[model samples]
Target: MSVRARTAIGAVIGATLLAVLPGCGGGTSTGDSGGNSHPKTLTYWASNQGASLEDDKAKLTPELQAFEKQTGITVKLEVVPWSDLLNRILGATSSGQGPDVLNIGNTWSASLQTTGALLPFDDQTFAKIGGKGRFQESALASTGASGKTPTAVPLYSLAYGLYYNKKMFADAGISKPPATWDELVQDGRRLTTGGRYGLAVEGANVSENVHHAFVFAKQHGADFFDASGNPTFTSPGAVEGVKQYVDFIARDKIAAAGNAEYDQNQSIQDFATGKAAMLLWQAAGPNLQKHGMKPDQYGVAPVPVQSGTPGPGQNIDSMVAGINMAVFKNSQNLDGALKFVQFMTSDAEQKKLNGAYGSIPPVKTAAQDPAFSNPELTVLRNTIATSAAPLPQVPKESQFEELVGGAIKDLLADAAAGRPVTTQSVQQRLAKAQQQM
Candidate 1:
């Protein structure tokens, strides 16, 4: 899926689907008496993950066929593009007409769950899927509001990493990738020369900007919110993190001048075309080949942390990010939907699907396949086990993305215009961002 499409899934939070669409009461399924015992047909809305909807269908058709054969159920699969999934879902959920099961970005789970538009995977419901213990603890934790039964279950898992061009590193005489932020800046300076840049940044994408800020801020011992779920964008640690990110272009001059307009795809293209040495991204493997970049030209590493800055925070990483699957509350075939969810989560299916998507399976055992133990995926595996966290599990996450993300975009714009971006100025922007929330 496109990065914007994936990130936009989380943007639906704080918007009222029920209020906007008339008489939308979820969790009101038809009381079909023979639900569990009989065979049924189900409708499923799957998000696009490959080159196109056709590619996604190619990967999933066989699996769905297998599911039908095994359970005596038929699944009508609809591959929804990321651009239209959220809106389609909103319209469906609000109007009481939607698919029985669907795929959503993991970050959107908490907010969507709050609407009661999806059925909660409580103890009993989980029994229909798999036991709760079948999932990774961190992955499972991201599926609902705090202290509530999750409305979804994890399907695929992913994490952020630094992707650096090996040839560029060799050209720059750097033998190793950076492990700390200071080293990154120093190496970035070395790699930057002539028409090439050291790092590729997605300054124009508000979602990408906020995700980067999330990573850097976490490394500096700050979070987007506090215990009470209030915005803390202007916090000392957050300010420092944002400054460091903006400094790549504003202060250090290692990033390209035109990067202020780059989105995630542009940055990825820059790295793929050898115009930039490094890019921070999640799941670039599938897209790399599509962009005509050879795998051997680049290598992946854990994103650098503020290791030199000793304190309570130093080596944190990104959220245990990935795709999640949920069954809607209003379905004619709720039993069939539940079975389909379980079929998707089964060990065999997890391995098959994740392998095809180049994603980690949320099931612990399924993730243990040799396919995921490669140099590229192993680092992500370790990161997920040790450092990953979900985006702030708050209802206002969409608002947070807009507010904090827009603030950073504004900073980048000012920097691109050769205007000053002082710490005090950043603080002011953040203050304004928080006010917008």
Candidate 2:
């Protein structure tokens, strides 16, 4: 997650929305028939969390087997790529043919809540899994719009960090990680020698672009939406924020020009292979290690700020990143689905699954496990608790990501092709996006 992303719902929002949330009334319940009888098998569409779909399946199979042994409920799993997850979920919502349970990017929680396709975690529903207090407040905050019942609860928690190759720094005589953007650019220059770049970015990844854009916007004191939920894409702060990020590739020249075409984890690959020195990513350590980059090879730090150390106020660094679990409102086996959710979020499962995936458990007890004591998890957990912010919970947030992120993607392309990326150019792109909204 990066609350992440690879999500949108503009065309899908009112497209045959089904049953409303629990306690909201006037819609179908989750059970197809008898509430007391449970299904023999449950379908789960898990988001791609490991090196590959096959890898995710391999990791989850044992857990699923254990679950079936204990509860007699077999889970049929499908690992969905980020590119297809949102549209797949939309198809389910529209056709009422979704899995019994699914993993959703936390960023989609509020937007998906509008469709009424998910079972709301209301008071009684919260009690079914555990208490509302069982999960961290930081992870819980992104579950849905404020003042509304959450449509889902956090399963795996993540936060962004500046992943730097430690050997590259030590060899370059850089003593510590940069604490501010200027220092980042400065350090980047020294490290950008001999064919390696200072930074790596997922320029074509819409969710990745939007996540970084959100962080920079916070540093510049820009909110993408007003209190009344109107889009504010071209505000001065917003333009500057977007520019600050694009400038890393454009003005700062820290990243490669070819990076503008990278949408997948190519940027991560670049960092892991030492083609780049720094990476701003969400819980990327395990993925890097999969590429043969060792824990001793790199270090994680809070994403840099404007001009000071990362903290509260303008220094807020990353967005709350993670996956959320949701049960389809019209699922055939509502009881089994709820049980599966309980099993997945249980303290034991949380520790096992989150530890394996290099994610911090949203469950407080699970996060406190010794497995999370490593430097990587420590930085991420602290960031989530102290510095990370959630994206706006507005219904149009996904649309905002699509439009603004696309605009930035184009801006990066232009910069990569030797075009100017001035404030005027940035605002023009955002203004067009605002009009689209």
Candidate 3:
């Protein structure tokens, strides 16, 4: 089937069959009741991660109390696992039993927008959340529908970076992380020896693999889409970029063996256990804390640039990613749902929530807050401020990853097996995949 036809069919199925929950219309309101005197309660869904869901509930207890004292509306919060969140939301929305507010991965924005399950935030609502000027422009851009107004608000932001062990660098007599692509390769070679791999890239997880690959493609002056939003993966720059990453693991043999099966967990474990010297990852703070590695033990820096790149000192391509907040279209308390979304994205709330979780604030002012303290976080914040780029917002983005990403993996396997990976073959494979997408 044609890509558009497939996308259309998927949207129809998603919207028509997914379960959606009903919102509370008449209940003992404990928070801001707004102008209307009708009592109401708001249902919220959050992902369970660091800071126990129970603790998140506890943290919000005070805020809920204050909100209730002021407005008399009660907030009911439920924590969902990351694995089940998307499916649950999809089912809930289709069944008309969805929550008033829910969290979603930033990349899922376009897909969710297509379901028509979310309500767009107008200018007035934007103002309530600290206005357009408050958020990182790229993040806000990622929240909107391709040809329409924004469907959700960016709740938090994060970007991928090179995290290295301080002791490993020092032991190798390397005083600093690489500033250029060539230097990174040299460092990787030097670090790879005696049962330790030089780097851990998410080579197996197609979604993550493509995310980092796009960062490299950007540094090489290529993008997944052209000015008209058509797929552009056949570009010479993109092909070269993909080769560079594949070569690191295959030709150079500097990445962990069996990397083809490595997911985010494998990469994280390799880095945390010192089996790998460096990892390109997003928001490693929580994981580091869990592993007992403090700031002083690790160093964070932007991904290095190729030797000859245009427009910058080091052509850093910050891979930005995060979750957005959305309210279902069938929601009974539309105004109340919007208000809750507004509260979550508000500058004050962004600061509090991001601070609690070590996430980069989505808002410009919140990102600049002095209280946002963490050495690694500071590096990430600075990188996002000057170099971040959004992923392709195409509705078929997920499908493209599955298709082209599989081709890249095949190329990697070929190269690792000492088989030639020709540019012509790569181009043919990618072109075919583009047609499929």
lDDT winner: 2
Q: Give the CA lDDT, 0 to 100, for residue 278 in model 2.
A: 99
Question: Could you tell me every candidate's TM-score relative to the true structure?
Answer: 0.91, 0.94, 0.83
Off by over 4 Å in 3: 1-39, 48-70, 91-95, 308-316, 409-425
lDDT of 2: 0.85
- Sorted by TM-score (best first), the order is 2, 1, 3
Give the Cα error of residue 46 in candidate 3, in Å. 2.2
Per model, how many backbone clashes are there?
A: 1, 0, 27
What shift in Å separates residue 140 of candidate 2 from its native position after superposition? Answer: 0.6
Residue-level lDDT of model 2, residues 94-185, one tens digit each, is 65666889998888888788877789899999999888989999999899988999988899999999999999999999999999999999
Model 1 alpha-carbon miss at residue 307, Å: 0.6
Best by the TM-score measure:
2
How much is the lDDT of residue 285 in candidate 2?
88
Question: Which lDDT values do the candidates have, in the order given?
Answer: 0.79, 0.85, 0.68
- On TM-score, the stronger of 2 and 3 is 2
* CA displacement after TM-score superposition, residue 176 of candidate 2 (Å): 0.8
